[model samples]
Target chain A: MASMANQGAPERRPGIPGTPGGQPRGRGLSMRTRQLFWVWGFLALPVLFYGVIRFYPTLNAFWLSLTDWDLMSEPEFIGIDNYTRMFSDPEFWKVFRNTFTYLIVGTPISLVLSFLIAFALDRIRFGHTFLRALYFLPYITTASAMAWVWRWFYQPAPIGFINDLLGRVGIPQMAFLNSTTWALPSIMVTAIWAGLGFQIIIFMAGLRAIPTTYYEAARIDGLGEASILRRITLPLLKPTTVFLVVFSSIGFLRIFDQVYNMTTNDPGGPLGSTKPLVLMIYQTAFSSYEMGYAAAQTVVLFTILLCVSLLQLWLLRER
Target chain B: MRTQILMAGLLAGTSLVAGTAAQAVEIEYWQYVYETRVTAMDQLIDAFEAANPDITVKQVTFPYADYQTRVVAANMARKGPDVLQMFYGWTDQFVGGKVIQPLSPEVFPHDEIEAEFFPIVTAMKRGDDYYGLPTAVRSLALFYNKDLMTKAGLDPENPPKTLDEMVAAAKAMTEMDAGGNLSTAGMTLDMGGQDHQWWREVLVRQFGGEPYSADYSQVTYNDAAGAAALKFYTDLQLVEKVGQRGFMDEGQAAFRAGRAGLTIDGTFRLGSFSSIEDFEWGVTELPANAEGVRSNYASYFANGIGIGAEGEELAAAEKFLAYISSPEAMKIWLDVVGELPARRDVALTEENLADPIYAPFLKGLDYAKTTLFIDEAAQRQNAIDMANRILIDGQSVEESLAQAAEAEQAIIDKAK
Candidate 1:
């Protein structure tokens, strides 16, 4: 059936100069063929780019995960050894837990915070755009700069803003970034805050996309504000919520910049308390130069990202 | 036509200029960016360029954190600098990664390098080849604030000469606020910085435990002496309460802000500390243990020719490396960067030894041990983790020491 339709396409397009039924098709390419030619011509560069730049390295990483390549000598095949080593390593497990902690705690907190802000800002007429821009400002700022600023805010009295405030209230000084227990959460707070701007902007756009008519109809049906939000606004915003759930989940899972910049001297430190998988991968690959081990970590992270994203999409899918 | 003749003459002029420019060999040199070091390097480059007109040197720098990664990436891409600066502890990794090549004996004879430079420079030697050379070397010393010492009712000029004396001075200087939090740290305790080095090479040895075997193939700092060293370090904060981890963010910062009475730092801090106005700081030898045993960690960043260079570029890099390691360059580096010269003849002079600020650091080099690190970052992280385990996680010193030893041993094994 598809072939029959394709065969009829050239005949149906008689107005096109190069169509078989309209002109001498032997001298020039058929209209359909030309269209395909143009499409492929435009696609060739990106295809070649992804092939060499992205896909090749990605596939090579999978191969490298099975071999021992220390970025110096020729890679030697050592199948499953990297994976076994990663599994047995206690540090890897610590980093694994840290990575998930970011995803589990960071995603929901950031989403809810951004949603609340967006919802509140949506109703306000005065300074709405200004407020939106203010929230979005952090997203545009450099991650390292933001992380450093947050680091300063966590410093002890006379230096850190938070500590000075706490000190004024006769409260004991808190070790925000320095404490092993507090360091991960402290870094997570920064990561979530850094991502809040982007999430808020996205949520606002999603809210705006929810037609006013849905809310109006719901109100006409005697729905309260809360009821309307629960039924009409939220149901209509499923697509946006799904996208953000996956996006923010992936972001939290791959959190690196904030943690790294915050703990620049000893990244993933205070005893590897805040290390995410990506940071671990970076340290293994760059610091330790254990390419195979790092590659295995990367593969694990890639699998987690894939599973988490898929699971989120499935859970949030419209029934 | 007249236009054709003019065009031809213009083309000839451009070619002639290009020909002349091509005669001058240009080589790039890379180092991590520290203000004084960069300035000193620029000065050396200027002098070197003046001396060798045919060779042009371009100085490139990256932030210290990103410098190693950049060098590795550049090496992998085959676009590395002609000469690159690297930490002495990175010698093994750099040699294994082939990021740097050994100096040719014809240009930098091993006998001369061994005889002229400080004995510690042998850290760069692998087998019979010397992979790099340093213009200046660094050793840990006790940096004390004179005003803070005076305020604590201690003699400002006579810094602590013994561990017990240092602890006493620290306790005297420590000040608590109304909330019982440290308002001023008597001593800055930063495990993430030079404290790790001090704990490994200085404290461990001073306590009678070698950090690593003589061949550097085994971990040996997990014994009783190692635990004692670890206890002494942590006790400075935990028991005596003279210092706090993460005080004023970093030990150097606390000392810089005059909130810290003393900090164990390397000679590299000399330039930065000297620049602080109204800050009366003094440098003294690291305090000896009760047995009067003293040990220190001496380290340096050495200049090496990248493996990427060949032929003319390689030759130029060799000459540049030679020039940078020369006595003249070492003197300039010492004066400008405040690091002790790498050569005994240049740095061990009566003037340098008698100079109050440099004397302690110079004296430290006499018994200083430079740990041959397999992976400096990982090994440093082990030390940092050991300290954190005791300080933060409240782990036992013996347990932490054992864990650190095992971790370091694994790293050495993996490198093998």
Candidate 2:
């Protein structure tokens, strides 16, 4: 790059006006060349890794989505046949709805739940670290293990903790993951719980970034708690909210582990009520061995992710 | 001088070891994760290696759920196992994709496969070649809780013999709490697992029809017989209300826990049932419908060599497979895994047939349906949806079954 800059036109700088040996251009050029060489040398491995494992596959997925390969044969270009199949399939639409249900409902519920916990935790001085660590535990736990624990929690009375509690309180037995109406919401609760710790930590960090003087200032001005939060704290927390909204929205959009693990017996079950797009993609690619179709669904998922993230950032953007 | 001689002998021994190491052929054998399976595989590999010092078998496993995915990915990278255990239904897709090898006559002769293995296991045959060979076979039977039956005032000795009798027994046995919810379910009908087999194999056959055409090109389970079959299952849940799925989270678990009076499950449950000392249970033939017919669904895991394998690796895989199908290996598999032998000679041995536990599964083999669907995943999902629609959505039996049949036909049509 330094050589390219030199090739275009040699820069004849003023050389710091009165400076004698202001690092002569040739020596400086070679020095810059040496730094760039080492910088790229350090970067080359990761660059090649991303090219082979990440970027190449991603780019190939775009092209593969237009073909009709089963991964065992030569990919024959079908010119949007895969996309047509995906759009026309009823299973795709069901998965699309289920995915949006997770994103639209899961994101707001998780953000608010985590934020409230974080806010309450930030106010507590005693056992604050212990409590925060307790809340952050799920974040580090393996998702499959956490999902199975929640699955046990959702079981019927005498076995499941949740139903047992409900039964003791004299409520009718509710089908947690069995009913079509309840399965998606049930999966969402586990997903939100699994992701809550990380969200709370992030929210706490955002909470700490706000200056305490502002709260003290609002108190002096006789602002109520709600008023102080609305006028001073929330506005300052706009950047954090935007970041979380986008981050959590993407998480919900690409949800697979929770749905896959929670309903391990028949994942995305009770008539496809809990079948998200990612699970559907996994089924198509691995179970059905339809590479082209899976790639097409991946493209659809990518487009949805792009639009959703952009819309979230725009909606949460500060004026 | 004595120390020099000893050193020279040690050097010669080291050279011999080096020569053996250089000539040994190591072949990977992929199996699904299971305690008994691992033990059985270790025993087989040990025996094979001891018999053939020139070959080595490396055993590896993945979880059953991800086994197919891992195999496909490894095969895609041209580093799949030299030999792998493939589910019977997956053989067509595997061979169609050429991810696994088709056994040549020299590798596995057709007559030998037919003569050695049970006639039913020959379902693995596609066209003229065999894709895999199973060391063991599994068939479904009705697992009943004798204690539950006795508590419900039903005779523990006499189990349900007909569909009507089973319903009567189940309804008689259902125990409800003061809150009016079922406490002990008379039976369990799970959409995710056994419901499909009941609909496709048991009930449909009792109603006098096959689930699919002989060519596997069409769905034949949509006629009056199919509707009647589905209605019988749905009626057991919705109309009779004898069984509630919510009573147990898993399909066969209710019966295993002794909460279910009767549950139709495969022979593989024998291994899981061995630990249930709390309950008195036994297997019986599945009940016939109004027409007095019987049927069962049997599926097996067959080990085969995969693609991109050549030279000594292929030879080693073939050698291991031959050893695996031998009666000695079959005996070890049966003893360790509680599975029936795939080979006719091994399975029909007087001692094996006389074993009390193997009797029911072996009896089922006479009337079991083994389907080799290419798009088995889609078919399974369709069946689950059918169960959900009739049981949960309150859809009519005709409407749901017809819809499921259409969906199944669509999948079959799309399959190559």
Worst lDDT 10-window in candidate 2 chain B: B244-253
lDDT tens digits, residue span A89-175, model 1: 998999999998998898999989999999999999999889989988999899999999999999877678998888889988899
Residue lDDT tens for model 2, B1-416: 99999999999999999988889988899989999999999999998999999998899999988998888878877889999998888887788777788776887888877877777776778887788889899888877888888888988888898889988988888887765667678888876666687678788889877888987788899999889888888888788998865556886777777778888888788888878998788778788776678887888999888897787778888889889978899899999999988877777778867766687788788777887676777788889888788777889889998999898888878875
CA-based DockQ, model 1: 0.48
Best candidate according to lDDT? 1
Q: Please compute DockQ, using alpha carbons, for every candidate against the native two-chain complex.
A: 0.48, 0.42
Candidate 1: clashing pairs of residues? none
lDDT string, candidate 1, B1-416, tens digits: 99999999999999999997989999999999999899999999999999999999999999987888888878888888899999988888889889999999999988999899878999999999999999999999999999989888899999999999999999999998877888899999998889999988888888888888998999999899999999999999999999988888899989998999999999878767877676688989999988999988899999999998999999999999999999999899988888899999999999999999899999999888888888888888888888889998899999989988998999899878
TM-score of each: 0.91, 0.90
In model 2, which runs have C-alpha deviations exceeding 4 angstroms? A1-38, B1-25, B309-316
Chain A, candidate 1, TM-score of: 0.91
True contacts kept of each: 0.57, 0.49
What docking grade applies to model 2?
A: acceptable
Go through the candidates in order and give the clash count of each: 0, 0
What are the Cα lDDT values of the candidates? 0.89, 0.84
